[model samples]
Target chain A: MSQEPAVIDVPFEPHGLPPSVAGAAATTVSVSVTDLRNLRYDWVASAIPGRLLDAPLPIHSSFYETYHETPIKAANDVPRTIADALRGQLAAQGYRIGPDHADIRIGVIRFHEDIPSAQTMNNCFYNLIPETVSVVAIAAALVEVVDASDRPVFVKYYHAAHKVTPWCSPGQPIWAPSLLSLYRTNLIAAMRDMVGQIIGDSHFQEALAKGGRP
Target chain B: MKGAVIALAACALLTACGSIRFAVPYPSVGTPARTPGAANEIVNVVAKDDRTDPGGAVGRNGWQTLVPSNDPAGALAGGMRAELAARGYTVAPGHAQATLDLVSFAVDFLPNDLPLQASPGAPGGTVIATVGIIVIVRDPVARPVFAHYLQVHAAKPYYFNTSNAPDARTVLSEAMQSAITGMIADPAFQQAARRAQ
Candidate 1:
């Protein structure tokens, strides 16, 4: 007799403007300069282990074992990769990157990649077993901004996930190139989406304008 | 032989019923490399259990319910305190510039349909774990400078057993680690710590 999982409502939405800042007047001032700092990146991979269940016919099955292995790797420095892309995007928007005393400051609250994988081991038989592997890449980023006066501006979070098709069927090697390529591709897409959102938001544009001609 | 086969099947079925209790060991928070110019400001850490049932079921399927052997809130707070200390912050009680609240911790299980296989064996399913926390930073005058809610989730699949206690514990621990990691990695959290009185 399994019970229903408890339903607990979170006190607040995952992403939203706090009531105190939601109604603040949009800044009419415009500044063309800004600085980006405090970008951090965390890479988290699934810890689910592979299990081998021996269910033989004509005999009583009583064997079950689990094995752990690292099936994923981070091939590149994601933080630097995203930072470079962001700099180029901001430059195209007519915003100059200043070294110091900028009117506006941009910070990344969260930038992490979660690589979760699942395995399917062909059931039963005797020897010569077959298996299939599936993996998914999920990435999330949270960005925040502050005006020159150090007043809190706004915070926004973005996330995306994509499934990586296994390269070899009968038995795919853990470190297949296809796995890494697709994983990186999806993470980059998430970063692009974050940039697009920041530039497209009217509120963010207004905050940039408040920088007042650096 | 027939009797043996029936007994094996019966054993498997019996194993899947009733309530399963397991303890979630305190997660290990490794020593974080102190960032250059990182503040060592004092931070007050508080924890609360906001779940409707502290001793209630954390996970379940059609056959078994998973319950924790220890307090979820206490486990979360212990992890957070260790992580903050490793990040070069002084974690203590009393008036401080920053306060971290470990609000709620919960876990849920969603079992996938049995895969079409040649024979009957252990089935597979998934478990989703979530952790929520609030970070607040105040100025000398006690004016709130930064406040926000962060929720982190981790979902993983399990095989060889649908109601695997170790799998549930692992996912829950992963979610808890992410919550603390996410908070410390946030630029706003860093700024607030630096600005704390």
Candidate 2:
């Protein structure tokens, strides 16, 4: 029962409507990346390595099981990846970046890759079996469009997903040098895909077209 | 070789598991004494879960963990309704003035390995399970007044054998129940519900 209450607040600067939208549709919109949040939690990052040997293994086996030692690199660098993707997509859509009295502010609310142990070969007895691990990545962004009075015209939530199955067999080394690189590649691809989905949302476009206070 | 095959088959069978049934810990629980004249008001309840498996998860140790019943969202909503009824509120199916949405639920377990030889302050084989919930409440006008995301976690240490360890499903369910109780017991939520009524 240690849960706290929810309190959400956002500070916005006053800026006039975008040049594009006058009557119904706004011709141009300015945007700024307010924040990028990484929500993935990893337990191994703080664990003391090599100390596990002093303790009895969960399951008794002579052959040691290989765990994915390297923390998910893509999860660690999500802010950079999201920032880059957002900048690229906005620039292409003629949205100016920086503090030039933006009409919209974008923020990443959720970004994470979850690979549960039961879904992986880590459950195998001494890595003697093969299993397909399903990695789930979910990304969501919050977009708020404001008028010159700093009043919110419209607010929208955009979400995207990526799922992939990677196989782990008896002979395959879990801590192989290339494993981290592979995970990084997959995570980055998923994040970029979600960014595309968000920026291309029809509702998001309509919000831009009907640029007025809600 | 024969024993190995049997073990492998056992492991596989355990992996391809079944659901865990969780019973309501307390039945006919009375409503909050403070929130009077609240029984006549009707409130709609909606629940949903976005997990890989809603029946709960099979742990790496082949133990079925965090199962909130065959249908968690429905069970949770039902549990809430029962609680509300005890608290003097009318829970209805549709067109109520207020709505409660159990939007998201996630359960995760952390494995712990510790030294077999007991020493001072030596951590034993402990497994920690954490449950998180996101709940939203909207007024009659459909404006959100309360939205909170909270996590409840439990941990138990195992000695030489894990057989004596607590069941993960039971632990997780208890944690979840406590969390739900915390939300409803909040004075702010009580005031809001009364005002809506």
Top candidate by DockQ: 2
Off by over 4 Å in 1: A1-214, B1-12, B95-104, B115-121, B139-142, B160-163
The DockQ figures for the candidates are 0.06, 0.16
Q: Could you list the CA RMSD of all candidates, in the order they appear?
A: 14.0, 9.6
* Candidate 1 DockQ vs. native: 0.06
Worst 10-residue lDDT window for candidate 1 chain A reads: A50-59
Interface RMSD of 2: 9.4
DockQ category of candidate 1: incorrect
Choose the strongest candidate by TM-score.
2
For model 2, report DockQ.
0.16
Give the RMSD in angstroms, all C-alphas superposed, for model 2: 9.6
Give one digit per residue, the lDDT tens place, for model 1 in B72-115: 77777788778878888777754354555544355554434322
Per-residue accuracy of model 2 over B59-146 as CA lDDT, tens digit each: 3332333344456556666676777777777777432433333323443333343121323234334554444444555566544444
lDDT of 1 at B75: 77
